[model samples]
Target: MKLRVENFGPISYADVEIKPLTVLIGKNNAGKSMLAQLIFTLMTLTEGYIPRRFLTSMLQHIRTTEDFIAPYLRQVDDLRKKIKEAREITHLSCVKMVVDMIIEYLTQYLNKTLGDFLERYFAMELKSLVNLYSDYTRVECAYSKYSIAEFTITKDGNLSAKFDIKMMDELIDNILKDEETNKLINRVIRSRGGRDFTSTIAAIEKIAEFIFPKRPLLSTLYIPAGRAGLLEGYEAVSSALIALASTAPLKGISVPPIPGMAYEFYSLLLQLTGRKGPFEKMSDLFKEVIEGEIVFEELKLPKSKMVYRFKFKDKESSVDLIHAASMVKELSPIYLVLRELVDKGYLLIIEEPESHLHPAAQVKLMEIFAQLVNEGLEILITTHSDILLRKLAHLVMEGLTGGRANANLKPEDVAVYLLKPDEKGYVTREVNILEEMPTFDEVIEQLYEEERNLCYLSLQREMNEASPRNF
Candidate 1:
């Protein structure tokens, strides 16, 4: 997937691609986090609950059946022939017509979907993110070769968006290729023989599979900055929200807006899942490196209240996560997510994984990230930590040098974006960051020269005092 933008936040223009191990790097306030959240919005878009539920339920039934598939495959050739005949007759396409109807129907709600995330995540009105100087802020999305949407947020906060139709008749055509599935599809089309309102919608719900079958939904989690603080207070925060909601109907109270990413982090923390996850090996690696583990336990209280504690590897007792070391507070969420929350193809969006760690811990964390990517988890991170970036480069080099070895990230799997400042504003461009690491040589040289001058001044003072000039 690729996202092109103009006049968004501090970003004057950007054309960033979303790769397996996508990275955003820039100075503070250069809009790296803003761009990261934008990508998250793309990954987690929804037409609405009804449509998603309808499609999910449809696919669940479709996925269970095995018969009628061969006949459906035969029908695909027929669909192609139909396309040729229909083009000659009406200059239209059955498959394209079906696909466009689906896209058009979904596109109606997509603007609100985008607006909801932008408004709630940033805790602002829709137009707040638009660059102050520009009248319009725009973003264009492409899922592989299929153009999804190009939306603009105007100065007055109106959202104007549209999408294009490429060759997606095959998507609908293929769904019609199965036998039992074909019967199910035929039932959906034929059973609604009346002109009632509910029947019309019911038909659309049943046919959702034909147009949007098996579109892989990207599961994404956004770990916001100041995660340590959020984790530290989430126990109390969650309790308070529950307490307020308990009497909200009587009191006519409304809960304040929590930042959407922080809300997601809290939800992840609160969820209690016992099914062992696939990333346990990598999680254990992290525990081995950090020399600690975060344990989760549930209470039988309201909402099945949850508690998380941190304990050292050699210790018998555990401490509440809030009372743990700052580094532990900062990083325990990573362990929790890998151990329970995410799986293969899940995206983990983290801002600055090296927040409180020292050099060794920071370097090992990068290695762990590389290992996770190798195992099929997608990571998008923004960091000012040059050490982490250098470690990433080293891992890429290791993978290349060791004949694409394990515990390293391949170049093709990683993309590095640099948000650079220009006269107009900040613009992000993908760079060959692994080939050459970013070295702040000029700044380092200046620092060393300043130290040398300080040393000279100290020596002169000592010599003058020893010569009795000061006495």
Candidate 2:
């Protein structure tokens, strides 16, 4: 399934779709993370969980209970003002009453995130989405398109902000009536640092879990970038994954297991050639059931320094949640582990898979992603790396002309979406990026410029000699 965002933050109105493997690429602060956060929030919301906590740990200045609640209050106030001035209608009208009821329901928790303060409110949001599909299978949603505030931290530790949503919603009133409108609101208001404002986050969590079918935990690794000590930064990942893991608790196998010798050999093959096994063609690991494999490394005492590790073997690896990796070493496994998962029908939502890695590694990671699409895993990645985009372009071309081609895959399936800034400065995202690639002449000129720059750096361009002719 693909996702489309219109008039949302940093975007005026853009439409983009993600087939199986989608890549979001852009410059720093160009709304890449925002797009990821938005989708991630929706994923959590649909699954029925409080997701604001996940974002707070990642963003600076968004830590703490009040930080989360503040934004929700502002949004609620905006919604309240609009409803109060709603068009003249009888109190009993379904539209009027629902609006009135929402207001009354919300006033009870004045200055609070409705989701965090009221259980019924949270449930109501979920009920809206599920009920919409139940009530109208063909319903469409319009984002309220609220302008996001341009926030900056003052020298004294306070935040300065500004917003402009005039071009955003086109019509805020229309947004309220749309069925999916509430889902969007619920997703945003309950995002990082949004829970303290509303108490119903727990209930929202419940609704999400109930509606969306849980895709089993395919072999995947959870990694977080190093900020402070291991213990300091790891908790955020642990909590987020734990929140996700709670949905599909492991039954027969242990919650986290170390990989067997076979699993390791399998992972190594992919790492070496950016391709998975031919072990069947080269070794016996493909035929035997390699037993007694440990997939997880324990967090020892003074665990602050502990890092997780796991592996998969050649030919025998399949999509099973039998392996585990720590948040510290997320990259090593996200790329390699995900291919195996997707090949077996697992959907992976990886957060900032590029964090803490070299530019070259970042590009290689995309090559691995192309491999996954070739194998068929539904992969969704949220990133802000330009190299990753170049890699995606290179790989998409390869998929169109190589042994890696799969009948089920499409170039669009491995799309590169961009989350950009709009007039209001709220984040907005668009896909179909490769379609926007530079023209051949433009590419040649860019390459020529790069070569010229290199010559200058090496002191190889003579002052007396004219530059080479342009072809």
Candidate 3:
């Protein structure tokens, strides 16, 4: 896939072609994330699995928890004000009479502002004090003496008043003296504390905002390569199932035998080895195991193993489909699944594959990506690691070494691009590897030697100046 981005944040206009393993190298704030989002958006559209209406509908309703809390508290204050005014200095007959009037006003306000069903309309829990006011032990109202701004209510009852924060606070304090009602209100406020429905809905809506073709899930996975030993082996089997389910061509394929079905077969084989891979002991009580024939040879196990006999006896090769060990062993299931997608011609946008991975593993990752190219996959990746860039350079050179083996192209096929910041606070690139081939190992070695000689000369000059006799 080719990407042409214009007026997209820091990238004013970028025209880049993607290969099997496209590596984007640049400094921070160079619009890498922007490019990644663009690819994700494109993938959602191309798959035809996402609906566009959901995106627009979602973006229109992005709100935070704070957005809900602020307005709710304000409404509570308003309700308190009306209740206080009806009780104090207004010749309102009895406390209950004032309470009834306030209740009517409150219900009226809720009906008008909250629109019939408060819960359904607000999308958050709203507990009103007036609903529980009859249970209060005492109800009192206190009016403030100072009158800063004034409005008139004529015989026709046309009235208005200037807003006063002090008057509002006093009115609220007076109505809050109803101990039972106050308790209920406090309980409601505390119970509904830290509400995040607004924020969560907002985020979901934001996801729906872009002209998306369908409502495909947008989530992230973190791979901790620094602790590969901690990676559970069964995770690989489950990941394969997820990959198969997500693929458009294999969308209906379920893990007919739910995941971890590989464990029983692995356990049977482990009995022959006498020693298991630590995780093999977890297969006991797997009675729900689906019966299937799995090829031992395809898994690349020892041919001399007694399990070889089991491979010959079978009817259906069901278990073999879930045995992803051969396809993904050392790599984490997340990367393994992603790798399979890339290898099968899917567009993959990866962020920071260098995290926790060894230098050698990083290099081999590039090799796997090249292998995917051979298998017809398109990939775009944003990386911050220098080692990753170096590895990519090495792979390009290696591809060149293959020469005519690749019927369609030459050594200059893979392109490398760099993004730089411009004066207008936009990102521009001075060199693009795709447009011009980056210096191969030969040119790099020459540059390294020249820098080494300069470094040695600088050290010699510093040493001469340090001599006491010369001073």
Q: What count of clashes does model 1 give?
A: 5
Compared with the true structure, model 1 gives a TM-score of 0.80
Q: Against the hidden true structure, what lDDT does model 1 obtain?
A: 0.71
Question: Model 3, 461: alpha-carbon shift in Å?
Answer: 7.9
- Top TM-score prediction, candidate number: 1
| Candidate 2 structure quality by residue, lDDT tens digits, 1-471 | 334443333443334454577666555555554445434333332221123343333345555666545544444454444434556323122233333333343233222322331222122232222211122111111112322112222222232223223342233345454555345444433342233334233322222222223333322222222212333333454555456675545543334432222222233323432334321121122112121121323456665432333335543433222233232244444433432322344555665666666776566566655555555456677665556666676666665676355322357566666555445443334544456642233556899999999888667545435556532
User: Considering lDDT, which of the candidate structures 2 and 3 is the better prediction for this target?
Assistant: 2
Pairwise TM-score winner, candidates 1 and 3: 1
Ranked by lDDT from best down, the candidates are: 1, 2, 3
Runs in model 3 deviating more than 4 A are 49-334, 338-343, 401-413, 428-471
Give TM-scores for every candidate, taking all chains together and pairing residue i with residue i: 0.80, 0.41, 0.36
